[model samples]
Target: MAQIDTIIASPSPVECRRLQNILEKEPDFRILAQARDLSQTYTATEALSPAIVLISQSFAALPEFEVMHMLFRVLDTRWLVIENGDACTPHLKITRNSDLFTIDLRSGGAGLVPLIRSVTRAQRRKMVPARPVRQSMPGQKKLVMIGASTGGVDALATLLSGFPTDCPPTMIVQHTRHSFGGSLIGLLDRQCAAHVMPAKDRMRLDPGTICIAAGGRAHMQLAISHAPQVRLVPSAPVSGHLPSVDAMFHSALRVAPRTVAVLLTGMGRDGARGMLELRQAGASTLAQDEASSVVYGMPKAAWENGGAQKRIPLVDMAAEILKAASMSGEEAKP
Candidate 1:
């Protein structure tokens, strides 16, 4: 068996020592580091990218804990939460998909050892690639631009579900914290037929690839190059968002005629003005109708303000997208 790298993060020195002692007994498990606070945990995780993090439940009380927690989920690390409370509590969650295991520290070595074994096994399985997948990115004259927020995650999953494996290059800006991008990519990748991944600076836009504009300090914009590429602009937040929807749509003004810009369910007016700009530039712009939207704020604004050419229901959105993208003629009106 290969050695598994693990970290212990806890506020209590006694708990840290206890975990250290337990981890040290297992030759196959290596204690890469120990963190006494949230700051150290974040730093160590980023630096080491450990296989497991034996984190205490108290660590959740630290400042900036929510931000760091979202960031940590992006990494391929299993969280073994050492809850000092009830082991038989109905709230205990130990699920493979969640990559989380909860155990009461009071239960002693019995619970911890079994959980470590289970987590390590799961980690090893995750490390093994089922198969290699390489998407052949061919440049298509057309592309799709999507801006969503609020209820964007489920909405995106539904929208991308209709995309074929070789659909046109698609880029999206979903209002989210910088650290939540990876988690979103992972969730969408599992549900979508097309290859989904985070957008990188200067990466070419090609068919069969879906670039998600999120994470980090920069906003994702279309590169001003001969061949269209993704450009990450390290600038201030626009429209109250770091990866603003308006920033992405405005960047594609030159190619708006060939782009299908859609504004989906969101709480704010971030993408409304940009969608209007694209519509005026001859892009096929559509906003999700109030009937299908969870909040109906962004799409409603777009439609009411004439930014979107039409108000489309979520169910009909996939078919409309396919029709619009495949049509060859004057801008296909939604």
Candidate 2:
């Protein structure tokens, strides 16, 4: 594993020291500098050039808009913000009900473990080489399904933007807070070339579209009858997530048996079992390799459970999916 250099910034001196001490104990991580305030943070980050920056919510006091702007400008690095109690930070906000806070870091202690894990994971992504695309064989119908949680907004945007307008019809399971799903879809629609919208109940699957599952009471499933459609399964949560990846993959297995299932960066094992099922059903399955994952737990679980046929970096995923789908189509042609 590559070494991860980090800068710790907190308005409170005690919190800064505490986070620094925790970061120092990790063999893979080095505390490049500690800052007592925003001014010190700017200076330390510029001079140290750390790969990640950990900012305590105290910085949130410096005008929410200004704080976020400054944070983005100073450190073109991955940012993790520590919140006070149940309070959240505008920058690096963890969505409600996401498994981001599941780590057992001490209270008011900056949750060093999750921060370190995020940084380490970011470093891994930076190291993977791009994969070359194989020539398309013929008659292949490529499909892409993605599941994401915690930090998914930016992650999903990054993953989707690489795809062209003619890319495969993609289904996404983004674990979002209630009422936020629609806005997220709108946001993604504007950012990417493909048409992005929330999956509607009983709607026929279409090509060249991106459907996102609703975060409310409904989970998206595939109805296997003629003109296979998206079904809203109002069921219990599996693996602690609603609109679960397990549900999506299971549906894809029945509907598009040969579709490619991709388990992207997320916080847990929600997609692992389903991905394995997809593999068993003769579908090609891929997991976002650890180096490019925002949180490696999901892809790691899929890879460990023998779910992934290929583990590719995030940047190359869109091209790979296109190549694989095109090849599959050619192979199926009479």
Q: lDDT of model 1 at residue 329?
A: 33
Residues 1-334 of candidate 1: C-alpha lDDT, one tens digit per residue? 7888898998889888988888789888899999987767877887898878888876643323433444455466777778766333321221222445676767675678767777667543333331134343333447788988866766787788777778788899887665567767765776567889899998988787899975557888887567889999999988888888999999988988888889998877988888888888878888899988867889998988899887888988876776677654384854
For residues 1-334, what per-residue lDDT tens digits would candidate 2 score against the true structure?
Answer: 5678888777767666777677677787888887776666755665676777777766633322232333343244565666654455443342322222222224645456655676447432332222223232244476678877655566677677776665677788887655556656765676576678889888766665788984767788767676657788888998888889988898887644557788887787998999898788777787888877657888889999998888888788777676666655335222
RMSD (CA, Å), each prediction: 7.0, 11.9
lDDT of candidate 1 at residue 284, scale 0 to 100: 86
TM-score, cand. 1: 0.61
Q: Give the local distance difference test score of model 2.
A: 0.67
What C-alpha lDDT do the candidate models reach, one value each?
A: 0.75, 0.67
Against the hidden reference, what TM-scores do the models get? 0.61, 0.60
> Which residue window of length 10 is worst by lDDT in model 2?
96-105
